[model samples]
Target: MISFVIKKGTNSNEMRENNSSLITANLLDWYKKEGRDLPWRETSDPYKIWISEIILQQTRVAQGREYYFRFIEKFPDLESLAMAEEDEVLKLWQGLGYYTRARNLHAAAKAVMDRFNGIFPSTYSDIITLRGVGEYTAAAIASIAFNEPHAVVDGNVFRVISRLFGITLSIHSSEGKKTIKKIARSLLYTEEPGIYNQAVMDFGALICTPTQPKCVECVLQDWCTAFAENRVGELPINDRKIALRNRYFHYFHILQNNSTFLQKRNGSDIWKNLFEFPLIETPLPNDFSQLVKTDFFGELFGGITLFSVDHKLAIKHRLTHQLIHTHFYQMIIPEEIPFNPPKNIFKIENEMLSDYPVSRLTHKYLETI
Candidate 1:
């Protein structure tokens, strides 16, 4: 139960400035001894830092670290990523869940090569112009790689700042964002903005965590308003909640000889550009008898004689905003079936199916059967 007392007759601005200096000095001193030894911290390359920052978004450092190593190993540099095909890049990023990040990385890499003549953009303006590069990412790259004095306001920083300042405003609100950004900028160490930013982020991640924050061991505990006021759990509020929509997916795994049929998803829906078994989405989970009577079922497997049908496998996969309940129906047919499939549908040898990148739902089904 550490406490801080402000001296009498001190101006608000002076008090704030003193607190800011205290936070920066104490945080940097703690960071010098406590910061995690991340691979990205070893380099000043904007490309590597950009990759790490992108990978860390909505992902934990432990999980993102392996993915980072894998990505770097496959595509060693920006040129390698730029030269790679979209499918190849997505394949490498298959299990990472957010396919759009991989797509944007590929696009941004090409933009660097084509638009910037293979040179990584140095200025914040040019970096933010690239696809999927937002303010936080741009700030991280600029500060870490170029020593730009732009303050970063990520989830970690939000927690640390909100608690330290005893802010109860919803961080998702515009006013909250403005307040957090202003405070972060005011407290930023201009001489070593990169180290200061990383130090603050690390302090939040390792000390001021969302659950069971290490207040007892924290260097800023005495100055942390939330900690002193016993409101650590209540600060840094977020009112925005995700509304998940339920979707039913009926996947048809039709096999002929040693090959299985797969369809490439098109358009701007979930799992776009990814391969999956021929699908028939329904309003609800329908029985096989009801499914077989539909026009879609007849058109897909009309002439082919069904040797076997297994309707036991059902998978409930939860995405960021959509909860997909997928049921895989395996239909075995003869080798010389005369049924013609759609243009997007093609037969691939069962052994070679692992080569293509499939959605997590499809991957779950494949792993089971």
Candidate 2:
């Protein structure tokens, strides 16, 4: 397979011919002076770039930088990441709230080994085919790593472009997405697409901020439709308000002797491939009194009688599109595995459970107890 040819010269002027002449020049000039000195930005390695992109997506750059350095030091190459144990990976990603990103990083590493013989794919299409590589991520990798002249229309770009072009379409709307994508692609300067893409993203994040953008300092202030029309706050329109789905998770901290019943998640959802206590999720909150009466419950707590009910802890967590309200019921059980909780919930030593990648709510409870 042919690899992307690395650029041998620095030429920002020629690339500006395709985009809004004013915006391109100003954006690149501002980036050269004010762009954050990110470790990933310093290298062309797709592996490092991919890791930084995933981390930054879920966290602010300041907070993500430390983790980025730590993670890179850990699994520096794709082979190391592929060979690392899942528990070790999760432990490295412990404080990072979105555990799915860590899981995908590991999965994609293995995928690269099995599919591409361990080398990271170089083209936009190949990168997009990897796990967790969406259009935005793919565009970033392709342009940043291989200088593919594709545009990355993330939130920052959405805000900048909507206001610059005076577009009134809701950014979340299909029509809005179509309009912005077309314009973004057209604006992509193919000659130095990598630098051009980075400049626009950096310009949007730093200058075209969500609130009180510095229009006087912006290069294309005169051409900006929203600014000219005195409606900078309303250009990047969005209509969708996420409806939080309330779920009642009753985690039976079922103890049989000194052991507890736990299981790792198996599906393609948040908390997937993580471990958790035996959980009973009801649409609405479950009545604790009735739940305790089930005969199967006896199998879990055979030796120890129910002491006082521990204080109930309620926690809320959000996923891509789901909100989880989890309630923990901590119980004391003996050392033996109970027969009642099926194989779906595996029996494990209480002391060793820390190695499992449990949910944040569960992690909180475990930390306290």
Candidate 3:
């Protein structure tokens, strides 16, 4: 029953053409001669590779490389990351916005320790089961680490394959994903899926770039429809992105006995594994003076030394569809939080503060203090 339906959707006509064979060979040859010497590219270690992949998710190679090196120096392996302090992890991830990836790496490290016994899951599905893993990440890790035959369909892959094959499917559409996945998988060389995958990704990033791609120099230009048709700008369709909603965050750093209370974000959202001071989110900016007078606000900073800093820094943190304007209040009080303070408010020491991972926005507050 499933076979008949599968036959209708599969694109076996392209599969039978055998066009990608020489293209794959030429591209791999080109990759061997021209590939960049990246740290992650040299290693087969799953942890290191996974870290690089996640860091590069919404970040560029150059910026992501700095974080990758910095992170590796701090936590060299899964055990170190698993045993590290939350603040320590966040601190390591400080400048690299998207604090959640750091937290997830930490959590996934712990998962590897507890469930996988400190060994990274080697299979495609097993790794995907990790806390923050998505399909694309799982595929990359699986293929790169264990040479699993799963096709990695990341942004680079979407762009390269969609344009090369002249597929007009929107890269963001459900059917488009299926179409690209089938094509990429069909062309994947089972013996060297990892190398092939990396080649295509690099080709897209450097040669098949989104703007003014160097098609004449591309080895795949013969098979690339966008090059032949001279429509390089039109292929690899993308759905119009919805506008990002503005979010205003105001944190009250209540100090009592030198420890500032913090709450870990729960559930599936941004900054999931990171620590933060008490947060009060609003649709728009509020009066800074009135913000400090809330019931819990008054108690947390009671006996205040008249040290209430407002809008100390403003940062625009962009997510997929949300743009958060985060601000921190650098206030100081006794070591003990007031009784009327909001629930879940804890205390942290100034020196010990560097041991936990706080959001990049939050890190700015710590740095200035």
Superposition error at 59 for model 3 (Å): 2.9
Estimate, for each residue in 8-103, the C-alpha lDDT of model 1 and write its tens digit: 223377787778888798899999999999999999989999999999886889989998999999988999999999989888888778888888
What overall lDDT goes with each candidate model? 0.86, 0.78, 0.78
* Order of candidate numbers by TM-score, starting with the best: 1, 2, 3
Model 2: how far residue 285 lies from native, Å = 2.1
Give per-model TM-scores: 0.94, 0.84, 0.81
User: What are the runs in model 2 whose C-alpha is more than 4 Å off?
Assistant: 1-19, 255-259, 293-308, 334-340
Which candidate number maximizes TM-score?
A: 1
lDDT of 3 by residue, 14-77 (tens): 5434565656777789899988789999899999999999998888899999999999998899
Backbone clashes, each candidate: 0, 7, 20
Name the regions of candidate 3 deviating beyond 4 angstroms: 1-16, 114-118, 253-264, 292-311, 332-340, 365-369
For residues 1-369, write the lDDT of model 2, one tens digit per residue. Answer: 112221212123343232355456667676788887788989999999999988987788888999999999999999999999987888778767788789889999999999999999999999999988899899998999999988898998999988877778899989999988977886777887888888887787778999989888876675576777788978688788988666767777766566777977778756777788877677776677756665545554443463435645777766667778777777654334334556576777778887777776787878766
> Which residue window of length 10 is worst by lDDT in model 2?
1-10
